[model samples]
Target: MKVKQKSICETCRKQKIPCDGTKPSCSQCRLRDLCCPGYQSDWIFVPHTAQSDRHSGATVVSQSGIVGGRKRIKDPRPNPKYQGARELTVPRVLGLSVSHLMTLIIRSYVPEPELASLDSNSNGANTYSQPRICGCWVEVLPNLIAKGETVALSSAVRAFAVSILSGGPMPIASLASGLEAYSVALRSLQRALRSACQFRDELAAAIMCILLAELLLPTTLNSWAAHLQGFGELMQLSGPELYTSGIGHKLFVGARPSLVILGFLSRKASFLGTDEWRCLPFGLQPPSAMQQLLSEAAVIPSILERLDKASGLPPRDRAIVDRESLHDFVAVLGRLGQWETYLQSADQYPLSWVKADAEEGAISCRWFNNITDANVLTHFWAFKVICLQNIDELAGNHPGMTSSSQFSTSFRERVGLSVMISQSIGYLMQDEMKLFGPSSVIMPLRTAYDTFRAGSSQCKVELRQCNEIISGILERGYHFVPLFFEAFRDAQFCPMSV
Candidate 1:
């Protein structure tokens, strides 16, 4: 017969106690304490066989609990809520990984003296930290301002380096791809990317785009590398400094010309003009006024006429005019009798070319010296007047009441246009400056500033309308993040797109 073996209580085996083995704890320990000693820390004990957990070599977890009996092991199964988490990894760029390329970029850009932050954070302590934007780990906006208070040259260089290492070079139409990659790469390292995502985030875009634009500009330059770097520099300025208020108009701000050109290029790329220009309906094309004039109730007739003709077309087909179309239209009138000359060579055209010539003309008596072209100025005014009229009377907001006469009418808008006409017309009279300059022919400013001015009639009527557009953009921006982390959580793997 087999030798009789004593029952080994799990509690006694776990606690190293002498056991007159019973069902749960040792009969001695339980009777004396009225509780099994190790059973109080039941999470640590494997039940059933007294020796079951001994061979596994896994440490037990102890939770505070009082147990009197040998309850079965409390094995709970995992639910769907706890399953299938995505693995985040450092994004790879080109052939090299993000970590490696960033090392290369930091190494290259750090060599510049104007860029001093390069060496200060050089210690391996915080070697690869990305700037905080907004929220949690996701996204890169080329806008730049969202990432930090000020754009530092070193950081700008680092971001550009990452963008280039990842995306190579991008056309103006698809610049966001590289930024997305930088966002992903940054998200996975040490910390999740985002402490703030706001209007400020545009700084990141501005910095990256400026760097990226530094690479793509100057079409005539045959050096591909030079072209790429040039475009990137322009993109970097899309930040609050250049893109913000009155300060953006400074001469030779570098990006001003390219942004003007980009507005043009983006306009050309959109088969349907959205932000830059509106189109006349095929059936109801406006021969008298290309765009509707301003009004309170009066302007509605023309707009309605245009809208009626356009309304029959699907909502998708309705053309909303924008900045580019206005500029292009201005260009058309500027070309005057020579309009065809510009059409074939729009791509080779940079705003700088036009501005440069205008400046030279003003400085030296050269092309377009005649200030007698009233027709060109008037046409320019017409485009602007119509643009202003469109800006007026958008009742998107209820900004209380005002005088009835204040209700903008096209005739009144023409009156408002007269204010701009006065301001711009005087520009041509500024010494011999216009003998060859841009502002010579009644001037070519990319503004309907008078129409938007607070004192102007259209601005009063359209203030709420403009604010609604601004607010709408803000509200829409809030949805940048998705509910499912998996959707953008994968950005860590592919930095080019978050």
Candidate 2:
């Protein structure tokens, strides 16, 4: 028979408060408004004694030594006053305070030079412990901090980190520290922006930091949009040439996904759609399959813009405009088709890059070689869905322009793409993928969820999986996802034009 171990929640236990044992959440924790890390009986306290230590044969204790300006006892075991002494329980997370942890995380970034051998030596490596933005922020920010380039970046990064680690409604202390750092970062950012020539790169990085923080702890609905606008302006100021190499290239690449989403949402043409912007950022480096995909996706906004313009025209003029838009849409669709074909035909995407797994129950999932590959695949599916939606919409609005067979084909493809997304959720929601995987899939998952008919069996199943993924995201400190989750939840259809 298993022994029933009684225990209080970790928070209450840490605080040394009396806990009225409860399931899910204890009364004390609920009263304090803390995100209580649930109950566990993993700890065992034993009175510190030579006899007990000898029996355990694990810990070695010195009989006498001066510690913290006090002469140690020869043997506290023999003293009645020290009879109740016990070993201190070490915290699972190594750090006395949030500030200390932040310092450790900031200092722990592996610069590019140091990370060189990682690829060769990374077999069975536990990369989960490394910082999330390894090649981008992790590579650049630490070096900048060391050189005293900017203090605000460091504080902003810390605030963002704290928000992620806390996982849910932050404790009072964690919230205070995060807000304090955030305030300091904002004030410093104001000064830096005023002197843009001196702190151009720093200004861009600082804005990114604010955007990241706003994702999880948003001040208002427009806060992220406002900050994103600033980032885009910074990009314009920096120009494509500036990002041709080094730290500039990394920053540009890091900021591209957000910029792409912004372009689509705004339904306006952007510089990202231009050939110069696509080719220049890579410089001497060969663009990855992901980069190539982004290049194709950037043109989507221009298509949306054309479609928007066509809608405002008179019927006769609209028909002419529709013909031009339809041609562009088909061209983009062909390009995406070629992209998919290239991935299969190219030597870069090895067979080992993706793995297929059997579904244990309701959740069917596939695993990828890494987070980047997973991101690329999900986004690919989403982009295809959007493109198809646009193509069908354009075709449908002007009758006889597009064949009925084309609509049937597009419908079939959309259904298949949604299934692919639903299956991939299992791997994407894993704890190890939290840093990059979860946030990257929000839009794709939303797109996938929208592909199905409402109240149908397929739609209900997809909705459940999406909800589970969103819950996992929130539980892992991606509080920003839920805000978007609510907005997408009730929507009957995706506004592809919007």
Candidate 3:
């Protein structure tokens, strides 16, 4: 019996993906300059050739890696900086007597492969260095001028929201508890915003900014005379601290745009339910998952109440009309949906053990314990979008807010603004203020915008930088932060490179 010729490896046959085929080196292997498995009956192809010619190209021909006559010829590209990491350490902030700037601590963790694969020549270069101290720093956000020494010793009432969301290692309960811890800052920011709401135009803007300073100052590292005795402690607490900077520390205030952007982010964040899940794919999706997700926002009785009052909308489609309302409702639904699904069946992604251990009690078959990795990032990005929209609106000064009816107005109040504000402030907190409560998360944005009417250049820059950072992180998780750190440092310190 005569047997026909065997098929080539998919990678080699297509060349679109990696493949090895032929001779001692098949056509695919030869193309990649590898010792192909050679006519081996079992079409097994190693992903890459050991002797890779990828970087072996001579003078700029194949700058990355060149293949020549079964050899990986070393490319003669000049090494931009020798000693790899060490050489890259020269403070980009070289000569200028730059202030220490703001006291917020931002330490970036760079992801490899994705971040490393990027061209170092561009703003997307790879480097995950921790935050370094630079002599020159600038704080443009101003302190609110006050007389008589802010001596109001009023008894401050607090909102203590205890979230029993936690069931186990997924730590929903713990996170909820931690979130309540931040009520202190949230309440203060809220009070400031509400207080400013009672004030007139210019003063409102100023006071609104002063409250923004609570979040923004910590983010931008700005402080002043009212910051308390001595400089050392102030400098020490400068990074991400409210109302203070450290000794001989360089403090910087975020400009108007930065403040506005924070508000926008908060607005975006509000759309992502505190306990919801959202999945993002490249194409169209069945509406069931979406419908299921939208139902979760029912936890926020207010949105559901407004959605009900806007009674004319078809029951099924009611949650889908306005972006903010739709987003929040869906977000809440997805979270609840995820929990329900986890109880039914657990997915293999997120490297979770829900499948094996659910019956064993390591984690529950309940809602909070079944959180997926995909869900976490999904909510993260969703919030970013809401924030971005606000950023865009604020950047352009969204003046045409007039709607044909009161529905849009109600929608904005119920869900829109909250989502936008959360996104902005979320980005601003790259440090200790990491975990957040659903309500507290959206405070900065609402507070800032309810007070300030316009965006400033500083606010814009920070927003752009932050959005880029968030985008990077969403795409590549932790690694993206480092690249941003390098780009940010290079720009803020050296600047010429950016």
Global lDDT of each model?
A: 0.30, 0.59, 0.28
Clash count of each predicted structure: 66, 0, 78
lDDT of 2 by residue, 126-176 (tens): 122222222344344543454554566655665555443332232212344
- Cα error, residue 420 of model 2, in Å, equals 0.7
The sequence of per-residue lDDT tens digits that candidate 3 reaches over residues 1-498 is 956344355435444544432222345664577544323255332233334324422111122221123211121222454112111100111111111111010101111121232344232222212111110111111121111112110101011111111111011123322233233334554465455423222222223223322221112222311221112222223322221232111222112112222323322222222232122210132222222333232234344344446558764454343445555544654565464565346434432222333333121221222112222322333433333333233223222433334333433342433233433433333332221211122323333332222333324443443344334333322221222233344444321121
Best by lDDT: 2
Where does model 2 exceed 4 Å of error? Answer: 1-135, 165-173, 348-361, 453-460, 475-477, 486-498
Question: Which lDDT value does model 2 have at 78?
Answer: 18
Model 1 lDDT per residue over 288-384, tens place = 1111211111222233334445546654454342222333433433443243243226435321111233342122211222232222343345444
Error of 3 at 253 (Å): 28
Question: Candidate 2: lDDT over CA atoms?
Answer: 0.59
Q: Evaluated with TM-score, which candidate comes out highest?
A: 2
Q: In candidate 3, how many Å is residue 283 off?
A: 5.1
Q: What is the model-wide C-alpha lDDT for candidate 1?
A: 0.30
Output the better candidate (2/3) by TM-score.
Answer: 2
Candidate 2 backbone collisions, by pair: none
What candidate 3 gets wrong by more than 4 Å, as runs, is 1-80, 84-346, 349-498
Give the candidate order by descending lDDT.
Answer: 2, 1, 3
lDDT of 3 at 368: 20
